[model samples]
Structure formats: C-alpha cells, structure tokens
Target: MPGFTLHPFTLLTASTVFMILPVTVQPAITTPINAALHAVAGPSDATDRYRALVRRLADNDPRWEVQTAAWSALISDVPTAVTDFLSPGGGYEKARARASQNASRNALVISRTISTTTATTSPIVHLTAIRASYGTLAEKDRYVRTGLKEAQDLDAKHSPVEQARQQAQQDRDYVADIALHGSGAWVRAAAQRAIQKSTDNDIQEFFKYSWASAAGCDLQAFRMNLVEQDLAYRHRLAQLIVLAQQAQHAYEQASEAAKAKAAAEARLAWSTAADTAAATQASWLANQQLAAAQAQSWQQVHDFAVTASTQQDWPTIADNAAGTSGSWSDEVAWAQSQAAEWTAVYESAKASADALPGANPTVSPSPTA
Candidate 1:
C-alpha cells in the first residue's frame, strides 16, 4: 500500500479492473491502448533507433517531448514495484521470491524503455553511410598531408634560388639605370638589350658583356686623356724653362753694362779732378813768383829813398818815394788776391779727386778700353 500510493494505477489494480470488465469489451480497450503504446515507442533496430531518438532530442523536436513523457510514466511504476517487493515483513523464502520477481520486472521495464525510444533501420544501410562519411574524411586528410609536404619541399628548394634571382635583378637594374643615362650610344644600346632579355640568365650575360666592353672603352679613353695631359704639362714646363734661361742671360748682360758704365764714370771724374789740380798748382807757383818780384821792387824803392834823404834832396826824395810806394801797394794787393784764388782751387780739386772711386794716386789709374 505504501509504495503503490505514489502511482495513479498499480499493476494489481489494472488486473483487477480487467477481470471485472466483460470479455467482449476487453479487446476493444486493450487494442487501442496497445496501438498507442506502439506509436510512442520507436523502431526495433537499436543503433538506428538511438540515433533517431538523439536527433529528436536535439533542435527542440516535438517527438522528444512525447517520448520523454512516456518514459517517465514507464519508469514511475518500476521504483514503486521494487519498493513494495523489498519491504521488511517478508520471510526468507518469500524475500527470495520477491527479489527475483522485482529483478525481472526491473529488467522488463528497462527493455520496454529501450524498445519505445528507438526506430528501426537496416544494418546494411547504417554501415554503408558510416563507411562513406569516414572514407571521405580519411581521404581528405591524406590529400591535405600530401599537399603540405609538397609545399614545404618546393619552398625549401626555391628559397635561395629566388633570393639569388632577386639579387641579380637588382644588380642588373643598377647597371641599366646608369647605362640608360650614359653618354655613349653603344653602352645605352646594350643596356636596352639587357632590359629586353627574356630570362634572368640572358639578362645577366648581356650585362656582363656590356660591362666588359664599356670598361675597355673607358680604359682606352682614360689613357688617351692622360697622355694628352702629360704631354701638355711637359711642353709647358719646357717653355717656362727656356724663358727663365733667357731672362737670366739678359739679366747678366745688363749687369755687366751697368758695371762698365759705373767704372767709366769713375775714370772720367778722376781725370777731371787731376786736370783741375794740375792747373791750380801751376797758378799757385806763378802767384808765388809774382809775390817775390813785388817784394824786391819794394826793397829797391826803400834804398833809393834813403840815399836821397842823406844828400838833402827833398824834391827828388818826395817824388821817388811816393811813386814807388804806390806801385808796391798795387802789386801786393794783386799777389794776395791770386794766392787766395789758387789756394781755394787746389783744396777743391784735392777733395774731388779723393771722393772719386779708385782716385788714390798710389794706385795707378786703370786704362779704360
């Protein structure tokens, strides 16, 4: 009674109610009930039925609600039946019988739950679908692995090769940039050809040949330019040396002319001084002789005056003394004037001869050729 109270109808109650009902009506009621139960329960194949039930449970499917309600009602009877069979008042033999019955009933309830929740599917169809899906995934994985390996191999092979190609392209661009703007027609044409070459290899070869040719031309041009510069420099140096030697020779000739002119001027100055000195000396000697004659005339006049004064002849003494005194005074004045004039000339001539170059009388004068 205690366990049965939880359910709306017990198994005993249902049996009793059926027994009370007439046999003719029993089939009608039982038939519809069995049909309803079958509708709620699913197909017989366990795996496909389970997959269907899980699909119904997902996505808020309405089938899951009906199946859940039915499962609840079915399992509600199990706990009550088990509780009543295992109650404490039973003896050992009865307990053993009840336990076995309870176990059987529990197993039946579980079996009914599984059967009602599942739908039927053929084993062959289920296996085929599974194999197709799995095969697709496996094949895709195999393809992905193979593609990744090939990609890795290609990258490893071409990395350095691509880098070298890029470097070569850069070098070609540098050369082309210069040559395209260069002065020479051939170099520029070569640069254009290098640019138009189809492959990196061809382009590199073109650049190589062009550079070699340009270098040779540049070397020849440089040599010609250097030679021209060197020759011009040498010619200029020789001309400067000739001009310097001519200038030096002219300077030496001019210096000798200046020395000869200076020596001639000195000789002329000495000769002029020597002639003046000789004239001054001759004039001084003549003046000295005239002074001696004047002095003798004065002495003769003084003796005549003394002889006349002793004879007492006043007139003759006055006349002779006055005439002689006048004559002597005039002569003395003339001698003094000539002596001063000659002395000045002699002193000036001696000074001029002393100041001239090489005018020392002890050093004989050099003959001027």
Candidate 2:
C-alpha cells in the first residue's frame, strides 16, 4: 500500500472484494483497461513490445520533453527497462504528471506574455508569442528559450529603440549635408556646432529630442535667407530645392522598405503559427490516444475486481489501481484543452495571413536632367 492510491474501493474490508480481475489473459484487452492489467504481461516477447512502445512514443510526440528524457534514459543505457516503465504506476504515469506540470507552467507564462504584449505597431513578436503559447509544450518552451530572442530581433527592425537610433543617424547626415551645401550662416553655425560636439548624443539630441529643433531652426533660417533673391540667395535656394526633392525620394524609399518588411514579417508569422498548430494538434491526438488507452485499461481492472477473477494478484496491485481511473480521465480533459488552444492560434494566424498585404512592384527612380 506504500505506493498505491487510496481510493474507497482500495479500503474494502473483505478479501473477496479486493480481488483483481485477471482479464489481461486476453492478450490484446478490449475491455476498458485499468493499468492494473499490467499483471498479465511477461518478458518473453518484451523485445518486440519495447520496440513498439518506442516507436509509438517517438512518432506520437517526440518533441515532448518527457519523451525526450525517456529516450535519453532508455535508448542507450537499458533497453530492458521499457516493460517496467510501461507497467501500472510506472514511469509512464510519472512522466505524464511531469508533462501536466509543464503544460500548467506554459499556460501561465504564455498568459503573462500575452497580457504584456499587444498587437499594436510591431505585432510579429506579440502574435508569434500568442501562437506559440498555445502550441505544444515543446513549442511553448521554445518561446521562452530562443523564440523570444528571435521575436526581439524582428521587433527591433521598427521598434522604438531601433527607430530612435535610425532617426539619430538620419539627423546626423541631414546636419552634415545642410552645413556643407544649403544652410545660411546662422543655420550653418548651428549645424556645425552640433556635428562638432564630443558626444554623438549631442547631435542626435540637438536634431530631435532636446532644446534646438532640427527643422524649426535650420530650415526656417534657410527659407528666410533664401527670399532675399541675391546671387548667393538664388544659388542657396536652388540647393534647398534639390535637398527637398532628395528628402522626398528618401521618404518613398523608406516607405517601400517598410512595406516589404511588413509583408515578410507577416508571412513568417503565419508560417510559424501554421507549423506550431500542426505540431500541437498532433500532440493533442497522441495525448488523446494515451488517455483512451488508460481509460480502457482501467475499465478492465475495475471489471476484473468486481468479479473477483484473480484473488491472488489483487493484493499486489489494489492500492495503485485506486486512483488510476481518475488520472486517466483527467488526462483526457487536459488533452482537449490543449487542442482548443491550438485551434485558436491556427485560426487567428490564418485570418491575419489573409488580411496582410503582399509586396508591391518597385517604383521607378526619378528621371535625371
């Protein structure tokens, strides 16, 4: 009774009531099984059964950390351990419990991340995390591992941090260009002072964030001085027109680049969602099957106990069988919940993929004189 579960039936006073059903003699039991049915099996053909279990576990849910751990433990070290592991109250149940814990933690992590991240400007990370959160345990863990870093990289393309850096660099170029070619004396002085600063932050700050406004000051002075229309004014005005046109060209280029990046990001997100959904779906199916097998196995044990078929083996397994049925039922519900999560992710990703626009043809460059 040390390791056995304490179900009501397990506490039955009469020896006749404690009898285990020996229904495992049927070899391939069809009567709903209770894993207490493990009393029927022996090692005569365990080699074939072991290999079969390996294939079943591998093909069904190879990405499962539990499966991976089992592989590592049994693959090279002790092939013979498979029989005991698959038996009632064996490694299989323990692994299932661990997987359940992992699934619970995954739900918590994904929920927190989903709440923190929104589908605003840069949605790749948000949606990607959303889908992976609902994916298989392996996929969910992957988000916590490398997927988060990858999302950050993708988000950084247009993220505030990266955008700020880009703007600072753009402003530096703008100031240098204005100082050399277009600005009047006052604006040129301002631009030069910014460029000459010891820290790059000064230039970035002067151009954008802090005290001196890049456009309000320099462009105003250039426009004001150009209106005089003297020989110097005319030359500077022509330069300013050229700079304006250049700015327009740069705007169009940035627009096209942004479009392309969005399309590519959307495509990748859809693909990830699709793939994760498929894998999670497969995991759901595998879990379903395992739960069904447990259910049937429990049924067999319950029936065997009622009829008092094999009183000799009853004491050996009575305690373990007490709660196996409940655990099997719980596994079925867990699998269904995971399946629903996968479905939600797949549908959301599919809709987003359909809604996103594709890349457009490149625009022709401006004609030269």
In model 2, the worst 10-residue window by lDDT is: 15-24
lDDT per residue for candidate 2 within 1-369, as digits (tens), equals: 112121322221121111112111222222212121111222224244344544445444423754764565366556446544544345554665676677678778778778888867556677667556434455667787788778878888865422223334444554565455321233344556667862564454434422122222322222112111111221222233333233334444556657666565655544444444445555565655545554444444444444443212343233334355555565566556545544544444344444546622222111111
The C-alpha TM-scores of every prediction are: 0.24, 0.31
Q: Evaluate all candidate structures by whole-model CA lDDT and list the values in order.
A: 0.34, 0.44
Candidate 1 structure quality by residue, lDDT tens digits, 1-369:
001111111111111110111111112121222122122123332223223222222322112232343344334454332222212221212433443454344444334433443223322222222222222222223323353344335444543222114324445554455344432233344556657764664355443334334322322232222222222322232233333233334444556547545544544443453344345345434534433443343344345435432212335534543553454344345434434433443344344335544546544332211
Q: Give residue 216's error in model 1 in angstroms.
A: 99
Candidate 2 has a TM-score of: 0.31
Count of clashing residue pairs in every prediction = 5, 8
- Segments in model 2 whose C-alpha atoms lie over 4 Å from true places: 1-47, 76-79, 159-369
On lDDT, the candidate that comes out on top is: 2
